[model samples]
Target chain A: MIFAVMVALLVTMVLALVRAFMGPGLYNRILAINTFGTKTVLFVAVAGFLFGRPEFLDIGILYALVNFVATVAVLRLTHLQDPWSGTEGGEAG
Target chain B: MSLLDHDPTGVASAQNRRRKSTVRLLRTAPLPAVFWLLLSGRYEPLTLALGTLSVAAVCWLTWRAGLAHQSLRLAFVLRLPRYFLWLSGQVLVSAYGVARKVWSPRLVLRPVVESTPAADLPELSQVVYANSITLTPGTLSLDVDEDAIKVHSLEQAGVEELRQGRMLSRARRTEARG
Candidate 1:
């Protein structure tokens, strides 16, 4: 069961990567990367449990914090540069 | 020649600020201390001493940066476990919904962007609401401004649910005073 969940998470991560590459605008890329990061955190935690090494959860927690901060930081920096330019990529909505 | 040197009120207010920061530092210290204990899982004297030193350093630095003031109120902290339980349920339901849509053969997306009123919520509550929206699947918080939050939802129903304000009310409740 755990292995199946891991496989599912891996598939989601691949999809997120595809989105990241194909996404039209900077925000789409950022959103995809952020989603990828979240899946990675979940993958790490599940993998830790599968391998019987619970210490991996700490890394998962750290990754989650980093992912959130990185998303916000990138958003802030881009908004400062061109706040209104990304509306053309509204398809990601 | 300096502002503090000439104005007694300025000196008093500066002193008051210092005192308030100290109180906040004391209140925030236990959080890091507990985190260290949980993460280290070590009770030896040397480890305990090091943990104390590190926690103190972290608390002092955060206090200096004026970040300690951002700590949640006791009422909010006490209610967090219940809030998280409810949020996890929402996450599970939405994740399943989004996953179903993703796996369907023909993509059925009715994306909409709408602004929801958030003027009544406190700053912290607004942040909680926005983060919760992002955490749940099918909806993303595009921007949060003084009086509103712009949300992007994969389906019209998601925006309608958000507009109904169940999550907003819960977010506000979490920060409510005892």
Candidate 2:
């Protein structure tokens, strides 16, 4: 059952990935990735607990660490160098 | 050649030294951490202790990849009751709004992104803000920037209300923890 839930959430994230790929801009893609990371963390933890292994919680923690790293990397990629720059005409409705 | 032996001369040839140092660190340093976890009975203590070498190997790689730090030991604990109260209120309000849209003849979806200034909060506070936004029905925090957040809302008014940073009121709660 937990695996089923994880799969369902993964499916939603796949839709999100499409948006990220067709990204109107960098911010959109980063946002999609952030959402994907959060879902992945929950999926790991819930599945771990459901399986009665609880050992998978370690993977959940590691996922969270990696997610934080990924966010920081994305932020650095988008903002650290660009600082004050905003997209000139990329606003999408 | 016995790689474990220490050199009397401090420096080795660069190529072999780099490779040897990398493999050496991968073997020694993580055993203590893996042993601690096994002793603590946190996970499957039995599996962990019995599989000590395997656990150590994984820990070594995890630490090498820089994932194994003693996770932040919260000096101030997570205030579950207060957080729960706030979360439930937000959930109720959001659900009500979503229900209204569902019942209405036309599905009203006015999507907007409000710029939210995100200064004066710690990193965890920012994370909390982003996560909280997702839990709400009418809003999704698309991404967070140093002094700003981009929130997508289901209605113009919701977007406006969020831009006002009422959502950031809880940042103080995380100040101590961070």
Candidate 3:
């Protein structure tokens, strides 16, 4: 069961990567990357359970924190570039 | 005499503020200590001493940064578990929905960027509300302002649900004073 979940998570990460690569806008790419990060965190946790090494949860938690901070930092950088870019939410292709 | 030399009221108020901050620091210490212990799970003398040092440094830095000034009511803290339970349910439901959409043969997305009023919520409550939105799949809090929050949703229904204010009310109830 956990193996199935991990496979699903891997598929989701691949889809996110595809979206990031084919993004029509920066926000879309950022969103995709964030989703990928979330999936990675889940995958790490599930893998820990699968392997019977609960210590992997600590890395999972750290990844979650890093993912959140990285997302916020990237968003802040984009905001600096153009204040109205985030709020408009229009495709930029 | 110069204004800096002998202003009794200034000196007294400064001392009082310092005392209050000290109290706040003391109140803030235990939480980080507990968090460190839970994460580290080691009781060796060296590990324990290092944990204590790190926790103290964090507490003092947060105190210096004025982050400790915003104290949550005990009622709010007590209600957090209930809020988290409800939030987890929402997350699961929405995650399922998003997953179905993702796996569907044809893409079904109605992306929206909408702002919802949040002026009535306290600051901490607003943080909770925004984070809850982000935690749920298909919805992300783009920006939180003094009176409103900008949310991006993969589907119009997600934004509609937020507009209905059920989540907002629940978040507010958590912080409501007894």
Which CAPRI quality tier does the interface of model 1 achieve? incorrect
Q: lDDT tens string, model 1, B27-143?
A: 888888888988888799999999999999999788665456666677798898898999999999999999999899999998999988877777678879999999999999999
B11-121, model 2: which lDDT tens digit per residue? 555566567656655555456555556545656767666567665676566545433332333343355457657877988998898889978998777777776677766
Q: For model 3, what is the alpha-carbon lDDT of residue B64?
A: 63
Error of 1 at B107 (Å): 2.0
Question: Could you tell me the TM-score of candidate 1?
Answer: 0.80
Interface root-mean-square deviation, each candidate:
19.8, 21.9, 21.5
**Every prediction: chain A TM-score:** 0.84, 0.70, 0.84
Scored against the true structure, residue A26 in model 2 reaches a CA lDDT of 85
Model 2 residue runs over 4 Å out of place are A1-93, B1-70
* lDDT, residue A41, model 3: 92
lDDT of 2 by residue, A1-93 (tens): 777887888897798889889999888988888888888888888887777888787788778989988888779776767532452222110
Q: Candidates' TM-scores?
A: 0.80, 0.47, 0.80
Clashing residue pairs, backbone N/CA/C < 3 A, model 3: none
Name the better of 1 and 2 by TM-score: 1
